[model samples]
Target: MTAEEFEKEAFALRPELKALASRWLGTPDDAEDMVQDAMLKLWAMCADLRSPIAPLARVLVRNICVDHMRRHHYTLSIDTTDVPDLSHGAADAECIDRMMAVVDSLPTAQQIVLRLRHIDGMSMADIAKLTGGTEVSVRKVLSRARKAVREQYLHKM
Candidate 1:
């Protein structure tokens, strides 16, 4: 695809990709940075891929996220102080926000797989392809992430 065509298609998919990145990164700034990097990489290889924004583009985005994690090592963390009394209506949102924070704390690979699978509604096969990992690896990461997130949720509860 030419640059113009690639730009158009990428624009259409930007929202979904941005949301995916934000969920994985836990911060809007980092998500935007990752998305920009992905776009640059996609533009560089625009001629090689076919039109309509190929799956490889998504994979590129995923890879960029993984690279960011590697470049800046992220340690898992959660702040459980002041659980915000779930009796209130806003508690649900607060609880989910805390849970998402915990999710963001996961190791990069596991975080990516988990968010892509659960939050982004991506399949195991798709995540595997995007991450260039085996299906078993994806499942294991997903399982480990879920276990950690579950532990946090239960603790908060």
Candidate 2:
């Protein structure tokens, strides 16, 4: 990507990238720093990057967050509270909360893949790209997560 294109993409994606970084790191300032770091890394490799900036930025931001966590000796725990409201009525809220708890009990990888696929409505390929895994692997993870949630939820219900 050219400098001008990179600049435009970076500007446009700032909010989204920052939000993703904040979500991963749990602080807006840290999120901003990470986004800038990702952007700098992207700028360094702008000439070699062939894909669209969005995917590349996402992958970089995720990597930066992981690196930050590792450096700070922080355990990686995905917040499951962002689960979308699938409840149609007051009675369904309890069910939704129960399901979310089940989801929370899942492995971190399972939680991430499940939320990205079902809650965030991301595509398998996109999840694979973001998570640095194969689409087949993502599919398998999602399948296992769903099955686990189903089995556990049935017991709870």
Candidate 2 ranges beyond 4 A from true positions: 76-157
Give the clashing pairs for model 2: none
CA lDDT, every model vs. true structure: 0.82, 0.90
lDDT of 1 by residue, 1-157 (tens): 7778887899888887888788777888898888888888888888887876746667777888888888889766777564445676766777778888898888999889988998899988999999999999999989999888877767766
Clashes of each: 0, 0
Worst 10-residue lDDT window for candidate 2 reads 81-90
Error of 1 at 109 (Å): 28
Q: Which digits, one per residue and each the tens of the lDDT, describe model 2 over residues 54-91?
A: 99899999999999999999876777664444555546
Candidate closest to the true structure, highest TM-score: 2
Error of 1 at 9 (Å): 0.2
